[model samples]
Target: MRNGKTIEEKIFKILTGVACYSLIAILGYIIFIIFRKGFSYLTIEMITQLPTGGYYYGGEGGVLNAIAGSLYIAGGATLIALILGVPAALYINSHLIRHKKTQNTVRYILDSLWGIPSIVYGAFGFTLMIWLGMSASLMAGIITVAFLITPIVIRSFDEVLSTIPKGLHEASLALGSTRSQTAFKVLLKQGFSGLITAVLLAFGRGIGDAASVLFTAGYTDLIPTNLDEPAATLPLSIFFQLSSPIPAVRERAYAAAAILTIIVLIISLSARFFAKRYSKSNLK
Candidate 1:
């Protein structure tokens, strides 16, 4: 019996290690390919200048418009998600704390929403745009992306808040603090790092999701100055560039992909740093 148990444990451990290493290898391969193909073409001109006339056909231009548009839409969407998600998460962890059934139901619904395909969100946003007499513009994209990421924000923050000791809640209430105050002041502080991670994750998702923004954010060559103007994103830029027959255009697509990858990497790193720092501070 002891020998059998040891063998079983060893097998599972080996399997887990294999799985972990496989994922890391795959990720390393992807990063290697993107950079190897893109580094040569990713020039200062590509990053700084707007696409020139006939730019898609190996013209002199950059993807600055796409970069700026992506930042604007993702940043706006993230801000909106943060504003809405934080309060909702706080409410769930505070008011609904005692009601396990209700809390679970809400979380299940959020998880379902999060799992829904981004294309579905695009279709829904398109429908909503027509009904509201809105065109495909930056505002439309921001709104659509916000809707897509809100559930993620809420669920991520809720999970964090849930992990906190219930004694903190009880203690705050015992000290004569209102539920609202306790939820915001005590719980929000405890879960601050998680909140940052959730927002950055949503931002990364919003920026990288071409499907969700394809219908809502109409393509544009120039950077949009207003919310009502059409915007371009890096994912769309890469898609369009890759579709071109020109080899240079294809190379540019890889470069755009590299840029997108780097942005997400930065967001991920920042999240880890902030989360770790704040977690330590909270502990202290």
Candidate 2:
């Protein structure tokens, strides 16, 4: 029996290792392919210039418009999500701490929402816009993306808050602090680094989601100057370019993907660095 158990353990370990290496291999292959196929097209001018007339048809122009537009939508969406999500998360942890059933219900709902396909959100947003007599605009896209990421942000932060020692909460309350005050002063402070990481993760999701913004953020050749204007995003930009029959335009698609990958990697690393810094400072 001991030998059988040992064999089972070894088998599980082997499976886990295989899974981990497989994931790394897949990711590495994807990155290598994108860089290999697109490196030559990733010129400074390609990033710095906006699309001119017939740019999609092998004309002169860069992806500056898409880059700026993506930043605008992602940033706006993340801000909105933070505004709504953090409070909800705090309430669930602090106000509903005793109501495990209710808290579970809320979390289940959030998980369900997070599991919903991005295209569903896009369609819902599209329908709402039609009902309100609104056009496809950056604001619409931002709202859709915000809806997509809010659940993620809330759930993520809630997990972080859950990890805090109950002693902290009890101590804060014993010191005559109100629940709200304790939540903001003690709980939030303790979880700030994790919350930032949550925000960054949500921001990455918002930035990468193409289906959610497909119908809301209309494709534009120029940077959106206002919230109500049409915009473009990197995912959609890559999708559009890849759909082109022209070889050069297809190559540009790979370049766009590479840019998107780089942006996500940079932001993730920056989030990790800041999280570490904040965690250390908070500990002190």
Candidate 3:
């Protein structure tokens, strides 16, 4: 039996190592290709200047419009997701804890929503836009992306809050604190770092998604100055550029992918830094 267990352990270890190395190899390859092709075409003007007339035909222009529009959509969506997700998570944990059936049902629904494809959300947003008589614009994109990430935020925050011991809740209430007070002051404090993580995760999801915004945020050359105007996004921008017949235009696509990758990397690093600092302070 001992020998059999040893064999199983060795097998598992080998599989785990293989999986880990496979993932790293794939990630490294992607980064290498993006940087190698992208760096050659990358220029300060490519990021700072807006696309000029006939820009896709190897013309002098940049992706400023896509960058600004992506930020606007992602920022707006993250704000909306935070506003909705936190309250929903709090409600599930603080208000509905005793109602196991209801809580489970809510969780099941959220999990199901989370599994739904981004393209479905995009299609839904398109139909909703038609119903509301609104044009494809930044606001539409924001709303769609917000819906896309709301379930993710709520589920992540819920998981974090679930890790807090029940004893803490009982003790807070035992000390004559009202439920609402305990929830806001005690639970929120304990889960603050996790809340930040949830928000960042949702923000990353919102910013990275392409299918959800494809129909809603109509492509445009100009930076959107209002809610009604069409906006471009980095994913779509890369998609368009990469599809170009010209080699230089295709190279610009790699540059756009590199910029998007950098933005996501920065956000991820910042999240880790803030989470670590908050964790330390909480420990103290």
Candidate 4:
């Protein structure tokens, strides 16, 4: 053997490390940019004030409305995604699809949908909602987010359920259980951690999405008076604010981005909390 390794080994190692370090560096740049700009908007008044004139008038206040809209719309989408994706994943994983052809077709379709651009999804929702006269309504944004989340949710759920021991599924069937009953009582119980991860993934995705909601969820200075009305979400507001040429708007965008990061971190951490506990108990 030539000394230690071939050139390919060294190349591969270098490439992998460079790829990983590149990602870390990019993330570091983002964090630094957000914090450096965001601190400018950290004042009590600035945090509370609504978009106003160049001076930021004393009374018009806070991103409380945007925050609420984000939570409501994103939460609604996750609910819809879970309802659709979980059942679909369960059916697919339960071997109920029967035909390999049909299963592959569905899986391929889902995989393709996952690759669709978020802005395209937003435009689609906007057009569809406007056509249906539900423009700027909560329903529009909810549906858009649902569309974005469904593929990811289905994939995650399928992975988890697929990873479950096939023996358990077969044993349940052998003991006179129906597909639904077996999945509900045994496979689901076992795959609960993965289901949780899927949920976290969905929540994280929904909360971070902006393009999908940009047109669907119309920007409103006032909070939504009813579900039929338009609302401003954190991400959309951030996008709009960031696009402005003003330094203040840019700073506000950075703060909103940091806030978005924090929210995602919390949701991920909570999901992992249950996972860690489940692992410990299973180990014991």
CA RMSD, predictions in order: 2.5, 2.7, 2.7, 3.3
lDDT of 3 by residue, 50-168 (tens): 99998999998999999999999999998999899888998787778789899999999999999999999999999999999999999999999999999999998898777677788
lDDT tens per residue, model 4, 117-139: 99999999988997897868777
Which regions of candidate 2 are displaced past 4 Å? 1-23, 274-284
Instruction: Give the whole-model CA lDDT for all candidates, comma-separated.
Output: 0.92, 0.90, 0.89, 0.79
Candidate 4 accuracy as TM-score: 0.84
TM-score of 1: 0.92
> Which model, 1 or 3, shows the larger TM-score?
1
How do the predictions measure up, each by TM-score?
0.92, 0.90, 0.89, 0.84
The best candidate by lDDT is 1
Task: In angstroms, give how far residue 90 of model 4 lies from its true place.
Answer: 0.7
lDDT of 2 by residue, 216-265 (tens): 99999989999889999999999999999998888888888889988899
Give candidate 1's whole-model lDDT.
0.92
Cα distance off (Å), candidate 2, residue 179: 1.6
By descending TM-score, how would the candidates be arranged? 1, 2, 3, 4
Clashing pairs in 1: none
Worst 10 residues of 2 by lDDT: 275-284
